[model samples]
Target: MAPLSIQAPDDGTVLGQLPTDDAASIDAKVKAAARAMAGWVDAGPMRRAEVLLQIAADTKAALPELAEKLSKEQGKTRKEALMELDRYIGPFIQYAGLATAVGGRHHQLGGGVAGHVERGPVGVTAAIVPWNFPASLFGSKLAPALAAGCGFLIKPAETTPLITLRLAEIAQVHLPEGLLDVVIGGPDVGELLVEHPGVARVAFTGSTAVGRRIAARAGQGLKRVSLELGGCDPFVLLAGADTGAAARALMGTRFYNAGQVCVAPKRLIVQDAVADEMIDLLTTRINRVVPGPSLAPESTMGPLHTERGRAVLEEQIADAVDAGAELVGGGRPDGERTGRGWFVRPALLLDPPQGARVRTEETFGPVLSVVRVRDEDEAIAVANETPYGLGASVWSADRQRAWDVARRIPAGYTWINALGRVYDELPFGGVRASGMGREHGVEALESYLEDRTFIYPAASH
Candidate 1:
């Protein structure tokens, strides 16, 4: 069979081809991973940590090359790609030190008996990553799985597998063979991995619709599934907040990764007192964001990964406009640039109708809907109206007031007076339809492990 072709999103240039995998090949890889799991268990904690550290070093050494490939294939700016590459260090280092943390616990019973809980690998684990933020998301799964003494298989998205394959190539040398595997294909390949009997756990990051399917399939096997799904996150500004700072912060969230981020601020719910001032400031920031090729340093934003993605954004914007939403700026392509890439202008819709598509659906583009609310109560009500509970940010002059507002918002992660920053030490995931299990931190590594309890009678000794 012919390999799948990967094209650069910037200019539709052919980057390379990756061989597709079938069920038979996937079975062989799973068996290989199962075999490698034994050796990994025997390697001990220090050795495992050492291997993770070495992988981190190798990745650091290859940052320049990896970032370039990521930018070319993933449709992110070169600067953003480099930032993703640099951020990989945090997970690798943190996981390396956390090797000692994934251990067993002991408890004494009252009747001369003791209970012991031992943590062990859940067998071969599959990590199905999405195209957006591939490298960073890979580390979120890979580092922790390695620390937990499990074999890891990566099934990267078809459009953006080059950088991940390159990382696998660099990593396999330092670790045991079969400890890390990379398979590139579309949804079929993912189906095989999720339904494979040998795979004990599935770590997935993508749309909620696909995540529901994967979770259902994994559940039939009684397998563990960790999902980082979609987000319709909200950004709120209270009456007393600094309009300038809050506007700039919220603007950055929508423009980051061209607003393709799962946790990007999708809805802007502002108090009526400062809504007009905030809109003016936000529009000023939005006007300065220039969309161009990902490789261009001056381009503040880049194109979406595919033409289909752009069309989806266009449709939603059109629907919102038709529903009486005001298109403020940058709805059409810039006249100065040639029409070659899948590009959309930065758009701000002021006072969109309640049923506007932009307000209801996850736009996943450089578009934002600004809605004014009567008070804090109305702001919270509007923020929680969406089905997604992934992430949100609340801005207020008083820290206590912001914290109070953040608590009322139903999201897995909420930032008070901040935006677009996630730490490796903190847990990252969502509630409701956003995702199933958590990723990052100690909880992430333990998610790939299963615990067994043993009770022994003292009389036997």
Candidate 2:
């Protein structure tokens, strides 16, 4: 089938048409990646780093074009999309340099000291990337794979395959033929990518349910796997918090990527002192966020990636309202083709009932759930109630108190008085249904690697 051009979620730009690879095409690419992987993985660390550095240079040169394409196809404004691309360069270079500088650095043990701890690639890797942050996600997974001397076959989300495909072309410039190949299709293609015989490990970023299925398939093959799944991270405003600070942080967390971020703020837990004030401030801030194509310089919010995306969000909003949640601001999209594109008005849901959609489901939309609680214990209990444990935040005037609450939250990463932001030098992963395995920091290189213990007694020592 030919590549398809999909509409942006809201007033965003079209995420350009993408060529859809057929089953045979995919098979060929998978084989090619495996072949290239074997050769690439065998190269010394210096060679791999050289190639990776080249990829970084190429990525920088292509930023403008890539960003334009990202906006057109992914519904991000050109500026936002460009910035996203810019984030990949540094991480990519960092990992590249680590390719050889990493591995078993010869750790010391008790007594006479053991040999060395070594890490090597597990061979071919398949990275199943998502749509919301295509370039970043793909690069995040792929960069480390390359650094670990692993070859990869990527199956990008059907809704946003443009960047991945283009990346394949650019990557080939620095890599050997078939070092990285991107295939486009739906969930079925992903199934194949995970289950393929040549694939040694499956690195996936998507929903929890899908992550489970992928795990099952990878299990059947006995292939190593790493999954980065969904989240409904909670943002807590303590009694002593500066309401203005909490409000500003919540807005940035809840509405980033039009709330399509898997680790975005899903529930707002506030203490009495700041509850009412937080709501008022949040409402005003949400209302002012202008909606347009993701490519537009003025666009702070864009349409959901698809009509179904909007529908799911709307249903959640409606369900939350029916369940007695107060709709604070905005309403539904005017029509299917309203406001220049798939634009949805930003909305805030206040005090949603226990079973409300805004409360229970991951409404990957321009809506947020606001809830009030009496104290820190209830706040923690409410925050931990959800199945997700990806990321969370706490805002309090007392730094120690904020840190205490942040630490107690059942999440992989916690922030005090700020939304969760990632550092490439640190680990990022979630517990529970948010999926397993660390994606960044030192472990990122290890994720694509297999460990080997080398023991050399007096003879070697």
Candidate 3:
């Protein structure tokens, strides 16, 4: 098979190449994991915790080198890349602390019977991570699986496999041989992992469409699966809210990572009373974004991870404009920098028609689609109109009012006067078409485990 080329989206530089994994290679890894499962589980949680902590320490020591590689391969500014590495480092420590806490309950029943409900690892687990935040998302799955005493296999995104492969390499030093493995390739490799009988559970983070396909295949085999899929999160502003503050928050949340974030505020629903002020503030801020190479010091935002992503974003903007939305602030940045990369100036579309694709679809780039509604009722209604139910935010000076509005929205996660601050302690996931299952917090750790009830008769006393 031909090797896959990893290129820098900022300058089309060939960063490196990796040989794609075939079914045989993936199967060998899965068999190895299955073979090593018992020893890893028998090592107990404390030993696993020690291994995780060591890996985290090693990862921290190599942060600069890893961040640079991430910036080049994933197309985010160096600062953003470092921040992503920080996000990665956190989950290992979080799960490591939670390791020994995984336990069961004992129950005494009548007739001299005693029952024990125990939780145990769910055998070999496969994690299929996306390109947008590879290292962070990988850690979210990897740390939890190991802490739960499960053998792990990973299929990193083809475009951004270097950092994940390197992290796995770093981890393997502290991990039992064949206990952790990475298979590098496109969707075919992922399909092989999902369908392999040796894989007991599959955790995926990607589009809802692909997630559904994975869910179906896993279901046929009666295997456990968790999916963190697409999202078109809403950010709503109420009448008395501070438009300036809201706009400032939106600039970071909406354009971070060039807006490839799955839970970023893709739609802005503002009450008519403050819609104009909010639009004006957001437009002013969007125009100031400096689009250039990821490693360049002056560049505030990097290119989209792929040319296809940039083109799709452009089409979404065009569709919104054709539907009569006002293109308030951004478009293709005009400069010498524009010709060499997949850069797109962050965009703001004001009052896009209700039926515009930007309103209905997940625009996975730096484009914000705004909608104006007459009242909070209309705002909540508009916020819940999308097929996605990943996340939404309500902004208001009145805490009670913001809390009420947040509850009225159907998303799995909602914020009050906040945009994109995801806490490690909170469980995060989506409802409806945004996909099912949760990541982060204890819920993630539990997903890699299974429960068994052991009931035995007590000896006569």
Candidate 4:
């Protein structure tokens, strides 16, 4: 098989090449994981927690080098790359603590009957992670799955596999051999893992389209699956909200990592009373972004992770602009500063028609589609317009009103006057077309486990 090329999105430089895994190799890994499953489970929760904590410490010690590699290959700023590593390490500690707490209950029944429920590992789990925020997403899946005593196999996004590979290397030093492994390749490799009977569970983080395919394929094999997919999340600013704060929050979340985040505020819905001020403030913030190489200190924002991603974003912006939406801020930034990177100027599309691609599709770049509405009812109506229900945010001066509006949004995760910040202690996932199953909190750990009930005579006890 041809090796997968790992390129720096900042300049299209070939950073490294990794051997692509074939169906045979993937099958071998799956079988190996199955072999390792019992030993990993027998290691017990406390032992697993100790291993995870050690991995976290080693990862932190190697943070600088890892973050730089992540920044280059993933096309995120150095600061963002560091933050991603921080986010990645956190789940290990969190799941480590939670590992010891995983347990089942006993139930008493009438007529001398009793029941004891126990949870066990779901066997080998295949984690398919995407390029955007690869380390953090991978950690989120891996930590919980391992904490639940499942053997783990990861197939990282081909474009940004290096950092994940490095992480796996760091982690495997503390893990049982064959207990944690990585397969390097694209969709074909992923398909193998999903279809492999030895893989008891498949956890995926990517587009909704790809997620559906994984779900369908895994369903055939009766494999447990969790999908964290695309999102066109809405940021609704109700009347009487602090427009400046909203703008600042929008600027941070929407444009962070060049707006490649799945939970970023893709749709900006503002009540008429605050639309103008909100738009003006957001526009000013967008204009200040300096797009350049990810490793450059002066670059406030970095390039899109792929040429295809940049092209798709450009097409969305063009389609929206042609549909009579006002393009307020940045567009495609062309200059020596951008070099050969896949960079785009952060843009704000003001009041695009609901039918426009930017308003309809998940705009996966630094573009915010602004929609103005008459009142709160329209705001909630517009928020649920998209098929995605991954995440949404409601901003209002009145806490009760914001909470009320937040409740109306159909998203799985809604923020009331808060930025798009995901808490590790809380459950996070999506509804509608955004995919299924949760990724964080105890729920994620539980997904990797299966329960069994043992009922016998109480007199036997």
Q: What overall lDDT goes with each candidate model?
A: 0.87, 0.80, 0.90, 0.90
TM-score of each: 0.97, 0.92, 0.98, 0.98
On a 0 to 1 TM-score scale, where does candidate 3 land against the true structure? Answer: 0.98
Most accurate candidate by lDDT = 4
Candidate 2 per-residue lDDT, tens place, 145-177, comes to 998888888888888876787877888888878
lDDT-based ranking: 4, 3, 1, 2
CA RMSD, predictions in order: 1.4, 2.8, 1.2, 1.1
Task: Give the alpha carbon lDDT tens digit for every residue of 282-383 in model 3.
Answer: 878887889998988999999999999888888889999999998876667778876788988888888898889988799999899999999889988888
How far is 85's C-alpha from truth in model 1 (Å)?
1.2
Angstrom error at residue 19, model 2: 5.0
Clash pairs, candidate 4, are: none
| Better by TM-score, candidate 4 or 1 | 4
For candidate 3, give the lDDT of residue 124: 96
| lDDT tens readout by residue for model 1, 1-461 | 57999988777889998789999999999989999989999998889999889989989998888988899899899998998887766788999999866789888886899888999988899999989888899888999898989998999999988989888888889888888898778998899888999999899999999999999999999999998999888999899998877777877677788888998898889999998888888888888888888988788788898888989998988888899888888565655442778888888888888888777688888888999999889999999888889999999999998999899988999988775688888889999989978998888988978899999985663
| 414 Cα displacement, candidate 1 (Å) | 0.3
